[model samples]
Target: MEYVTLGKTGLKISRMGFGGIPIQRIDADGTKKLMKMLVEKGLNYIDTARGYTVSESFIGEGIEGMRDRFVLATKSMSRTKEAMAKDIDISLENLRTDYIDLYQVHNPNMEQLLTVIGEGGALEALKEAKEAGKIGHIGITVHSLEVFEKALEMDWVETIMFPYNIVERQGEELIHKCSEKNIGFIDMKPLAGGAIEDGRLALRFVCANPDVTVVIPGMYDVSEIEKNMEAVEDVSELTAEELEAMEKVRKQLGTNFCRRCNYCQPCTVGINISGCFLFQGYLDRYGLEDWAKDRYGAMAVKAGACVECGACETRCPYNLPIRQMLKKCAEEFGA
Candidate 1:
């Protein structure tokens, strides 16, 4: 496995870090086995979030005695000082760790930063947490270049996590900016949340970018982990033709791409909007038609819950027409 220095943290992370999101769907035993396999394969960095249901707990369970074998990071969405402090405690307990390698503010918008750092708020709490030795490094995760550039200006932040995929090149400039600032750049949605069919090509495309320190792709199965790990062995440099092919795929898919940014959340109707789009992408991209159909059928709201209220579109940074796309998904894949 190829290891790269995670920015100014001075820690080397595997280029293929284990993303903790998919572990929420696996049982305790399964998670334990999968994690052990990953660690055995020399994958060292693990990233999880409090928002991903039982993800942190599962990771904690999986890596209990083997904590020192890997670099662990998690995030919290809490904006207030009190909430941020509380969430940090909860994450610590869930992860069963005394000190996190890195802790991040999850998906902070401009307004959130203003509220959290502008006036004696969560930033102070983060500093206190670091001083208390609860977290080794402070970082932020965001979807837009605007917020990422803002984060680069702050000397306190040592790392950054954001979306960067073959389909979405919006973060290229920000990735370079992070590299210049020595900020650890963790690429989320490296496969565009399963939107890209050719996983090898997609993984290689992101790894080819020198600015990205790590690419955290969610893997539930051992085979999937191995497939991703294999990409590291022979890093395929994308030629001009390959780049054009990726662009063509992106154009053909258009608004169907789900960056998994989770901006259009809380669905008012309680739909797993990201999952719906994700499974659909799996069918279109990977030819897992039956599995995708079954998964979509199992969703509470399926695709029909999109009320066409335009709320999701307005909130989406990518400007996806979620309602219309969901309707199409329902027609094509919903049972």
Candidate 2:
């Protein structure tokens, strides 16, 4: 695997970092085996978040005796100082680590950003914890390109995690800004949450960007991991023809790409909004129809949960009519 210094943090990370979300679905033993395999293959940067249920715990359990062998990065969404301290402690216990290599604010919305970084907030708490050696670096993960550029202007942010894929190039300008500022750019949703079926092509597209320091793709199976490793090994510069082909695919996919931006969230009826959009895309883009159907069937609220509330639409960065989309989803996939 190719290694690059993660900008100002000075930590060298594998170009293909292991995103820890998918592992939450696997059994403990399965996760352990996959973790071992990934480590053996030279993938040392593992990224997880408290929001990804059981993901941090699984990584901790999987890497029991090999804790020092890799760099561990995890995030918390807590905005208050007290909650931030508690979440950090909880994360440390879950990850079986005394200190984290990188700790991030997990996709804070604009309001939360102001509150957290404002006087006597979570950002101050994080800074204090860093001084205490709890985390090696302070980073932020955001979904909006605007927030990303704003983050680049901050002195405290050393790394950024955001969505960047072949289809959604909205983050392109922000990626260039990060590179120019010497901030590490971590590409999340590099495959557009499996909306792009040809994993090799999607992975290659992101890696082709020289500004990207690491690309984290969530893999659930060993075959997926092996394929990703192979793709990284044989990584080639994107040819003009290939770029045009991908652009064609992007046009065909259109607004079908789920950046997992979480812009349309907190449904009035309490639906896990992003999950619904993601599983639907799985059926449409990756042909995982049965899997998508099963997952949709399992939602407690399902798509019908959207109460025609205008809240999500107002909040959506893409201006997606979330209520109407949810209605469509319910008609097509709700149990």
Question: For candidate 2, what is the TM-score?
Answer: 0.88
Question: Best candidate per TM-score, number?
Answer: 1
Poorest stretch of ten by lDDT in candidate 2: 256-265
Candidate 2, residue 235: CA error in Å?
2.8
Per-residue lDDT of model 1, residues 1-335, tens digit only = 98889999998888889988988778889999988998899999999999999999989988999999989999999888888888889999999989898989988788998888966667777888999999898899888788888999989889999888877888898899999989999999888877677787788888888999999999899999999888766676777887887887787567547777677886877878888888877777668899988888777787776667777777787778888878877787843
Q: Each candidate: how many clashes?
A: 0, 0
TM per prediction: 0.89, 0.88
The clash tally of candidate 2 reads: 0
> How far out, in Å, is residue 183 in model 1?
0.9
Give the distance in Å from residue 49's predicted Cα in candidate 2 to where it truly belongs. 0.7
Whole-model lDDT, model 1: 0.85
